[model samples]
Structure formats: C-alpha cells, structure tokens
Target: MPVIRPRRLRQTPAFRAIARQTRVHPNELILPAFVREGIGAPVEISSMPGVVQHTLDSLRRAAVDAADAGVGGIMLFGVPAVRDAMGTGATDPDGILNVATAAVVAEVGDALVVQTDLCLDEFTDHGHCGVLDARGHVDNDATLERYADMAIAQAEAGSRLVGMSGMMDGQVAVAREALDAAGHQGIAILAYSAKYASAFYGPFREAVDSQLQGDRRTYQLDPANGREGLREAALDLAEGADVVMVKPAMPYLDVLAGVAASSPVPVWAYQVSGEYAMLEAAARNGWIDRDAAIAEAVLGIRRAGADAVLTYHATELALALRG
Candidate 1:
C-alpha cells in the first residue's frame, strides 16, 4: 500500500498554478466608477481611499485606463448636482449619469462593455431608490414608470448594459419592455437581484453623496435571508435579466453560491465600497499584505461562483493578473 498526500501538488508554485480550479482573469472583473455633475476634478472619497468622484474629463481618463488594463467593463454611477422629488435628472437626456454614460462609451465602448447604474437614489432628493407616495413610502408602480424612462435614457446614452440596482419589484420587466419598445432591444439589463441591506453600504453612500435620513431595508433584501436571495434571483431571471448579481460579495458568498448554482444567466457579485475600505484600511495600517490580501479576497469571490465581479480593485488586479 502506498501513502497518499495532497502536499505533492502544493509543493511548488507552478504545480499550484496548474492545479488552480478558479482563476481571476481580467475579463471577469468590472470597475465601478463615480462621475459627479459639476466637479472640475476628481474628489477622493474620504471613506473609500483611492476611490473618487470623477469629473467628466477624469471619468474619460479612468475609462481609458480601465480599457487599457483589459477589464471586462466599467459600471458608472452619477452624482447629480440637483435633486428633485420626481428624480427628473434620472430621465433627463442631459443628466449627469446619461452624460457620463455617453462619455465613457465614446472613450471605451469598443474595448469594453460600458454599463450604467439605473437607479434614482443619486438623483432623488429623498435618497430613496424610488419615487415616494403621498405618505412618503416608496411607490413601487410609480417607480417602475420612472425606471422605464431611465432605461431608455441610459440606452440612448450608449450604455450597453443598464444595471437595475434599485431592487424595485418587476423592474427588470419594465426596463426590458421600455428598451424594446424604444428600439433599443440590444441593450442588456443587469439585475441587482439579491442586494442585501447591509452596513457594508455605508461607504457607498459617501461615494455617491447619499442623502438618506433613514434606511433602505424596506426594499433591499434583509441580510439574514439567504433563501430570499435565491427567490429574488429566480424572479429576475424570469423577468429577462441578462445578468443577476449578489452584492457585498464576501459576506454573502453563500448567497452568491446559491444563485450561481441555480441561475441560468451570468451571476455577478459586487465588492462594495465598505469592503474595499476595510481592506485598504487594514493594508494601510500594516495589518495585512495589500496585494496578497486583495488577490485572495477577489479569488475567494471568483471561487464562490461569481462569473464576474464588480470591484474597486478591478484595474489593479487585472494588471497584476496580466503580469
């Protein structure tokens, strides 16, 4: 009888590399970027180091950089200069997000998929993801009407993928119908299917200059409900979502795996702002090896079954992977 050991495969770097079951490739990463309405220069987000609110000029540069780095795509979020009850900016053709989407598409459309965040939060004065009713509760059906308009706006702006991150019920169907009716049937919808209401979103609020006075737990999935995440993914798939996503990837890897295992469409995950901030803060404090930790963190997400990851580290990690 011969004694067997797994150590033989782990004995060398080349062996480990060859035996790796999951690999993080440049094409499997999407960079999430912010472009502000009136900024002349990029403003670094205090809560998220190395992440910034970009001016239109700076956004073009960043898009070029991401394209050069070979990232699969760039997801754009706009910080509007003005806000309104109806979130008029979201549907306006000259709105900040629409403008940024067009600019990024022109800069790197041929090189990578240019995506837009199709949500009203950044444009709404109330900071809710949807329009409010008479009593100030989010109006689901009314918001769907707004989403339809926003979907067309994004498509006209040259966004190849419109990320429906507002988590509105039936949003994917509404956006799909609106896009097809408007002769923009080629556009894809990336549904944020199982986005959890987590504390992990705190830094993102800062990044987008959020104006919320309370919380979004009413719409976003509760953090404790893993089964509910799967149900949401299924709903999105049935509603014509080209892709479905689980956000705050690391904390919800279990949910990610659940969706990945069951969904027919591509399953993507977001490494949100707080996650990036935590890793950066730790690395800056010398508590962890920055590059190694970043690599491992993303690799863990990839291993958990994300077909692509929306991450702040996309460019850097893509470069490292290419090297």
Candidate 2:
C-alpha cells in the first residue's frame, strides 16, 4: 500500500471542495458605510480607493444596493458638520447619523439589518470616544451615561443593532438598560469587545474626518494581549451583548479564534480600513491578485470562527459570489 497518500484528496477539484471547511457567504457579510453631513457629491476616501463618504441621498442608494446584493447588514458611521467637547451630536436626535440611519432603514426596510456606530469619536472635537475630565482623562462613568443616551438615539433612529465601539467599561450593561427603559426592548447590542489600539485605523481617520488628538490606549485593548480579548468578551456577554466583535480582523485572528471558541454569543470581525488599503495598494501596483486575495482573507476570517464579517469589500464580494 502507498504510505499515507494525503495528496489523494488534494489532487482533484471535487476532493478539495469536499475538504473545504470554511466559506464566505453574502448573508454573512456587512458593509461599513460613512455618511457625511454636508456634501453635495460623494467624496472618495483617498486612502481607501474605491470607498467614499456618501451624501444622505447617496447613502440611501448604497444601502439599497447592499440589501439587493444580499448583504447581511450595513453599519453606518456619520461625519457631522461640527464637533464639540461632549460629542453632543452622538446623542442628538437630529444628528447626521440619526438622519442617515432613518434614511437607510426606510430605504431597505426588512431587506437587510441597519446598524449604527455608537461611538463619539466622530463627533467629539478632541476626538476621544468619550468626554474628558478636568484632568484630561476620559471619565468612564460619565461616558457610560453618554453611551446610554447614544444607544437610545440610534435605536430611535431605526438602527436594529447599535455597535458599541467606544470600548468603555460597563457600556453594554448601561446601554441595554437605557434601551429597555425607553421601551426599545427589541434593539440589539453589538459590542466591540476586543477592539485594539492598532495603527490599522490610520485611513479611517480620513474616512470619518476624525478629530482625535491623542491615542486611545487607555480604553482600547493593547494589540499585544490575546488573553485580554477573551476577558473583555466575557464581560460584554455578561452585560448582555447580542454579539461580540474583534476588530482589525487579519492581525487578530488568534484573538478572534480564542473568542470564537469560548463566546456563547455570535463572534464577528472587522476587516478594518488599513487591511482594505493594503490590499488595494498592492492591486493597484500590479503586485497581487485583488479578487483572490479578498476571497482568501474573508475565508480565512470565517475559518478563524467569525459568524459574520464587516468589510469595505462586502458589496463587491457579494456581487462576485453571486456571479
């Protein structure tokens, strides 16, 4: 007998297909969208090539397109026309995010889930995710109140799921309580449980026109710690997170796998701005096969145990998969 012919399965397409353990589906992908307050035309994010900060009208069209493509959801981030110390726009019923959320929900209806980025960084003048204390540090308890308010605002704006990406301690519990009290009991929470302070967010600054003055090392997880990611997930789950997410998915696959293995709730990952930029840059330089690389990256994320993935490439990937 031949000695353990492992190549037998690898030798044919049918065998390879049967052996494949992971796959990317349109229904498991969510598109991340940026909608700006005062733009007559959609503004392309230079760092993120094909991606753009959409006007309200354009954002509506994009959401409909994503829904028609069979994407699972669209997570909206708003760029307001002004900023303040308290990030008031985050909780304002009339805020740009709220308006955009309403528009998307109305446009797509039940075709796809509409989610909102429940972070204040985009609205704060100082660019921190929360309000600052007299000493200049983020006031954790005070910030929790703001988060609770923002959650209710997003929920009222028609966001089915509010992504708590601020990484604030006790935020999930507080937001959950606020939503329940406001009689928005059906709203869900998608906690950014394992978001890390990575350099990968560089391009996102331009996308949101972020005003961040300093690093978020105090609140965001350190990139070096994998075990901490699980702890954060556990805490968020205990506080009633409907789903837990690991951000900048490619660099944190180990963390993603660990969270997926232990998490009782669904595990999702964000293929952040930097990851998308690298692939685009290489493709533009004729250095890599973009489509194949995109497929491989998303498949690898799914294999690492992500139940869903939020990516800039969601619509394109969905269209390609359908073909």
Candidate 3:
C-alpha cells in the first residue's frame, strides 16, 4: 500500500495559510466600550486591566480610533450618574447612553456601525436588567414596556443597532413593535439570546459601577443548560432579531455552535470581561504570549461559528491584523 502523509500540508507557512479553515478579519470584530456620564477622564477598570470607562470626549476619540482601525462596530454601554427604581435614565432623551450614542454616531456613523446596549442594569438602582415589582422580583411585563421605550430612545439617538441584553421574555418582539411604530424600523435589533449568568461578569459590574447585590439567575440562562440556549435563540429569531448572540463566548462554544448552525441571521459571540481578564492576567504574569493568546482565543470563537465577535481586544486586534 502507498504511504499516506497528511503532514504534506503542514510543511510551510504558505501551506498552513492555504489550508486554514477559518480566518478572523478586522471587520468581523466589534469593540465594546463604556462611557461614564460624569467622568472628566477615562477611568481604567482594575479587574479588566486596559479596559476603561471613558469620558464623553475620550469615547469619541475611541470611536474614531476603532473606525480608523477598520473594526466592524462599537457596542456602547453607558454609566449614568443617577439611577432610579424605574431606570428612567435608560429612556431619557438626554441620558448618558442616548447622548453617548448620538456622539459616537456623529463621529463614526459613516465609518462603522454604532450599536447601543438597551439594558436597564446599568441604569437601575437595584442593578437588575428590568424594573422590579413591590416583591423585589424583576417584573417581566413592565420591563418589556420599558425596553420598548428604550428602543425608541436609542433609535432616535442615532443608534443603528440596539442590543437587547436584558433576557426578558418577548423583549425582541416588543422592541421591534415599538421601533416600527415609531417609524425607526431601520434600526436593527441584536438579541443576547444565549446569555448565561456566568461568574465571568464580575469585572463588567465594576466597569458600569453596578449596584447588583445578588445574582441575575432569574433571567439569564444557567450555564449547565446547553439545550435551553438553543430554545432562546429560536424565540429571538421568531421575534425578529437581526442578530443572535451567545455571550461569555469561550465557556459556551458548544451552545454558540448550535445556535450558529440553526440561525438564519448572523450569530455573534461575546468575549466577556472575565475571559479578557484571565488571559490578560496570565500574559502579565509571563504565563503566556499576550498577542498570540488573544488572537487564538478570538480565532477559536470565530472557528466555532461566530460571524462576528464582540471583544474588548477588538481595536488592538484589528490594528494588528491591518499591520
């Protein structure tokens, strides 16, 4: 019998490049940014090393930088100076998020997609993703009403895409209805369909100065249920989600793959704060190659079926890819 050697394709860089099944492009990366309402300067998040909460001015600069580097989009998260029980700021025309959205859209609207996080967790006093009832539980219906209003606010503020990350039932449908009714039907919805209540969200709490005293297990998916994730994706798709996302990407790649395989719309993955922190910490300690590890981690998400990846490393990686 003739000898068979698959190793022939692994002999050179050109061969490896030609045989590569997956590629990560600069335009397939989205940068997630935090803009604080009252900050005069950018505040570096301790847990998330290089990630920062930006002043409005700094956020504009960052958006310009991301656009210049050819990043696909920027997901804006706002930290308001005040929080009320109803999360009034989330729907306020002059609220931090709305203002920041307008600013970024004006700065980079022509260059990149400007997306906004349409969740109440950063605006509510209790740090929940929705309004709470008298019983201190998240009120799904009331929150849906709030999300409907938020969608309009974000749309009016020039956000091309509104990310519904609250995990509330019927949220996508409600937001879609409201946006259409308000004649902002051009604004797309990005549903955080398979977002899990993972421990990896710790640093994000600090980035937004979260008021969460307990957990969000009531709404967010449980890490143990992979099948449940697919159900959520189906529901979001039926409700008119333009894009479905699997958050905390690395930990739930199996879930991501399942969603990508079935979803007709684009599927995205979020490399959450914890994932970024772990790799950064190891690299700082000399336990790994920083650039190589970051690239591989994002590439793995892409290989697992993410059409695009939301990452804090988007700007740097995009720059490196272009370089």
Q: How many residue pairs clash in each candidate?
A: 0, 0, 0
Off by over 4 Å in 2: none
TM-score for each candidate, following the candidate numbering: 0.99, 0.98, 0.99
Evaluate model 3: give its lDDT: 0.96
Candidate 2's TM-score reads 0.98
What TM-score number comes out for model 3? 0.99
Worst 10 residues of 1 by lDDT: 101-110
lDDT of 3 at 59: 95
Q: On residues 78-97, what C-alpha lDDT tens digit does candidate 1 reach at each position? A: 99999998899998999999
Tens-digit lDDT track of model 3 for 1-323: 55998888999999999999999999999999999998788999999999999999999999999999999999999999999999999999999999999999888876989999999999999999999999999999999999999999999999999999999999999999999999998999999999999999999999999999789999999999999999999999999999999999999999999999999999999999999999999999999999999999999999999999999999999999997
Best-to-worst ranking by lDDT: 3, 2, 1
Candidate 2 yields a Cα-based lDDT of 0.95
For all candidates in order, the CA lDDT equals 0.94, 0.95, 0.96
Clash-forming residue pairs, model 1: none
lDDT of 3 at 187: 93
Q: Which runs in model 3 stand beyond 4 Å of their true positions?
A: none
